[model samples]
Target: MGKFGIAFTIAILMVACKEDPSAKEESKQGFRMTDEERNATPQVQKQPEKNFRTFTNLADTTFIRLADFSDGFAYDLRYATENNFLKEKVYDCAECYTRVKTAKALLMANKEFEKYGVRIKFFDCYRPNSVQYKMWAIVPNPQYVANPKKGSIHNKGGAVDITLETLDGKELDMGTDFDFFGKRAYHDMTELPRKILENRKLLKETMEKHGFWSTRTEWWHYNLSGAHKDKVANFKWECE
Candidate 1:
């Protein structure tokens, strides 16, 4: 009786030691990696650095040029026009460049405005870090330039300065000029003419809905969110 009991106990123990067939198969199929094994695996390399050129805004001078789109405005209009604006600003962040594309999309979205002949007029876009440094050196105004250490959103290629005009080409009186830096540009609902103020509101609301935000000091300035927040290599785009 003792020998048989011992034999039966040994057989039961062997059966218990055997792994479940389904679990064994699953363990073979599932992902398994030791820390060293994971460390040994080569990680994907990042994309090669983008080649970029340098471009300086001519308006950086005292003789303010009305950007190309500011047709009637006496300011020198060099990069202000549609044809030249994008190339005017350097593309520091490939991702942030979507702001320009979004602006164009906004224009196309308002097709009815096209019938009325109205369109967005850009004053500036994508300023290079060097140009920003130059501007800061000249003015050194915090109101205009964020600390170079913190960097301007423009430096990241995520901000734009723009205005609106009629299809027949009448510029909406924005209560203040593009670079004006006072209370007038504050999006004051009570100060401007109902129509003009309403126009400002429209521009702000439209741009905000499209992932862009306006600064309090400059109604025309809008920064696209999550675009190129890092300091890119300082380079300019050359005219073709």
Candidate 2:
């Protein structure tokens, strides 16, 4: 072929080889990764199950004072601590609507407890993602705060940190304070007083009955059934 014709053919080939941005994006959208690529890709590590606890509303439990139970707990209590901020606002983790439903379910399940003058005293709930990051930064331990990218079960709107309180508002002795990170929180069946042990057992049994389970470390920590256990979500509870 003549030089001009050859050059023209080469230019056409070059243009054909060049990728169109939109077409390239469409190709990416349609492309399927091979198993090797999928496995080799760095995955976002899931938040480890640090504290293993569950919750339940006792049967026949009653609330005598009818105080706003929601007020006692942090709005973000379910996911991260109050220290986590989003959009320049500190969310109340406990005040999350999803947690309120769970709490209400517990109250409903334990009508007798209400009559007997006992109610749930929440410590924390619905943690913000940013706050979880901060907790991890401080501790760098999954036992305490979840990795920000992975997130905690609380972020899923299903876990709660709580304890039982009497009708007159006295906290039950559950071995250690909520979020206590040592051996004290472990449910050592033989170590605590009989009454305190009984209280712990009672709490465990009641929560288990209503689809919650306690962590091995903290008595007050309980997770709702299969909610936050397996998934990493970006749900943030907003409180005005």
Candidate 3:
């Protein structure tokens, strides 16, 4: 009777041990992940393949797409949209093209801004002289739009309209919106809050360090020191 009882107890214990998968895994020194968990991955965007041209052979005055050089910069390209002061689209499409010298300086300045948790957000970049005429036809004011006949530094690919934006795309207050024609938009205006002044100062000072100078009338406008000599280009960029 005792031997049969012992055999029956051993058989019952063996069947009970097989019920738990986790206990089996513990014995095997492993764990099992659910199908969903095993396949889970963090979402990431693949960077576009760059076919950028080298700056070495290009002249300082050569025109180039700023995005071709670096993806770190941001662009608004207001003239390419109706949101600008003109209330009409002047550019065929939005693109930031600048002289080699201007692009080089901006790339460097943006790298510096990155250290401060900011980056440059362009409203406008190089302006074809013909687009200047289009803007003039809309505003036709020297204070607002440059005269097409004489041309501005923008026509020479030496100028850019920009502002500071946090790395997450939050725009810093610069007292007024881009192309706001008033004393508030003036760089010398100090009626603004300290935060606005500091933001503007950062932009102006860093640009100056990069060989760009600010215009007195528009806080967003800047010109490369020696880019006025380049011919005023009338060609426009292709949009697809």
Put down candidate 3 lDDT per residue, 16-116, tens digits, no spaces: 77768777775686767678976999689999887766698898888899888888888898888889877888777889999888999998999999999
Which numbered prediction scores highest in lDDT against the true structure? 3
Off by over 4 Å in 2: 1-104, 110-112, 229-240
Lowest lDDT block of 10, candidate 1: 60-69
For candidate 1, write residues 93-159 as lDDT tens digits: 2222223343343434344334545666656656667766755665677876666656777666666
Of 1 and 2, which scores higher on TM-score?
2
Least lDDT summed over 10 consecutive residues: which range in candidate 2? Answer: 58-67
As a whole number from 0 to 100, the lDDT of residue 155 in candidate 2 is: 64
TM-score of each: 0.55, 0.57, 0.80
Instruction: Rank by lDDT, highest first.
Output: 3, 2, 1
Full-model lDDT for every candidate: 0.58, 0.61, 0.89
Off by over 4 Å in 3: 1-52
**Using alpha carbons, what is the TM-score of model 2?**
0.57
